[model samples]
Target: MEKVRVLVVDDSALVRKLLSAMLDSDPGIEVVGVAADPLIARDKIKQLNPDVLTLDVEMPRMDGLTFLENLMRLRPMPVVMVSSLTERGAEVTLRALEIGAVDFFTKPSSDLANCFAESAQEICAKVKMAARTRPRPYTQVQKIDVPPRLSADAVLPRSQSPGTRGSTRIIAVGASTGGTEAIRVLLEAMPPDAPPIVITQHIPAAFSGPFATRMNNCSAMRVCEARDGQPIQPGHAYIAPGGEHLLVMWDGAKHVCRLHDGPQVNRHKPSVDVLFRSTAASIGAAAIGVLLTGMGDDGARGLLEMRENGAPTLVQDEASSVVWGMPGAAWKLGAADEKLPLEDIAARLLVLAQQPIAGARRAAS
Candidate 1:
């Protein structure tokens, strides 16, 4: 099998060396070259013609974002960002993803050597994933008309009341890789009174807060980072905070968000498996599970559990996904009740949310 070629660009000599060593250690990957700045990186790209690029957000000659914009415009290829675990880094990394970068890794603040040592597997895996990603071209901006908010009671099924103890329905969504944009497209299209949504998108600490804020600005439903013990309610979406696992649990008569600092599941802190498994256990037939565009099978088994519990489950179709690995795995496992395009997912979800939970499950089965 042909190895995936990689180019590492960073102003820090240590970071570049550490990254190269980590990536090269993997038999499936080869570090083609290293660049100290974007200017040098640009030249190396033309020369090496690498399959993937690992870019630093802050570099000497030119910033990563600016170079990324130019690269996407001129010669689009898969790129993964190397970012610091800071608020500013998080904000900038999100922008890079919007600009067509495939994925990202957050640098640890302390113990650089130990951090790289711990993240070696992750670094290699992302590079391989990046090589398989379909790079979409950056085109002219299009305007999206923000729809007006509707009452929660109006959008949901008459069989259940909104946030009435055990009477509410829940939606559990999981995504990674190209998930940020995939999620924005889905959420922005949803009606204001859609069922409460709980999401676990692979991201680093500090990034999930900003991500939720950004999603809230564009989405009809209120989006916020999940907090421990927060009540799940209609017309709202809770994003699992990064660096922790987010779970849904019954608190007396109400469903509430539970944050866990437990060991990473399937190599992810905020694993989709954790969220889907929790929902399957707590919400059962009262829930809808969605597995969106991502790079691995983290949520496949959890989604299967949801299906086995009589919950309707959906997976984004391969044609619309940036990386169809996650959804494909779920579909192969027979976990997906329906496979639909990205543009059609929200509308279908709205229809499902309006049906009696039991009826929906029966129909899906």
Candidate 2:
């Protein structure tokens, strides 16, 4: 296969050299050009037409954000923002992601750091996959008109919803792409004692650490990345590491996490399917499964199997999704017992978790 062509842009010659060397070291990627600033980058965009562009946030001539806005407006392609690790930098990168940049990373501190950041292994992996994606024109998203905040009580689940069946006391969800903000809506409105929650959002190595920190600061529930052997406790939410799959195992009396690096399922290492399937297997008939906004069908079949194994499932309604790909695919397979708008999901899920499970099981039996 032809190598993925990359254009590296940074104001610093050292950063340019480091990025170019790092990307070119990978067998799957070839640095076609390097630009010292966005001014140079703009010229090369028309000439080289590289598959991906690695951009620095702070640069001479024009700032990266301004360049990115212009790039998306006139000629949109897949661009990865490279920013320093700062509170403000993170906030900017998150906005860039929402704006349509595919992904991001903090600029490594030095040449050695750059080498470690995109090791020969990861560079090859990311570039190859990125090259396959279609570069859509990045028209800025117009703010959609929304109705008044519907009271949380309006959307009730079907009789088969989780709380209606005793075993549904806990809810586990996984998502990617537009999930950061999506999860914030669902989690913030939820009460303090929401079901012991676990989630896996496909994200970058550096971003997940800060992402968890951000989520914890914003939501009422305690939120953090999962550690191996950490017991699955209620009122807390655990996110799996970005590049590893998180599996759940019952350790005698209590449930514990077993973070592993098994084969990638659904083209993702920290796969939603892996988490949901294991939850279905271990906590069968006792858990509620949720597959939310994402870019692909990563959780579709596993969610279906979860439903088949007697778990109730909820999927995000298409109207509220950023992409609607994952949930739409799951709904097409008839996996979701309930579909909800993003805002109401937390409220309805809480009701399901509180339903009397014993009575529902008695009826099922």
Write the residue-wise lDDT of candidate 2 on 1-365 in tens digits: 77788998888887777667667666667889999889999999899999988888888889888899889889887777777766567777776765667656565565555344434443444455545544445502222333333211122111233322234366778887667778777778766677888888887566667777877887889989888999887788888887777776666566777787665666566888888777766666677889898777888877886788777899998787766778989999999999999988888888878765534465345
lDDT of 1 by residue, 218-257 (tens): 9999999999999999999999999998988887668899
lDDT accuracy of residue 139 in candidate 1: 9
Question: How many collisions between residues are there in candidate 1?
Answer: 0
**lDDT of candidate 2?**
0.73
Output the lDDT of residue 256, model 2: 78
Q: What residue pairs clash in candidate 1, if any at all?
A: none
- Scored against the true structure, residue 147 in model 2 reaches a CA lDDT of 35
The number of the candidate with the highest lDDT is 1
Cα lDDT listed for each candidate: 0.85, 0.73
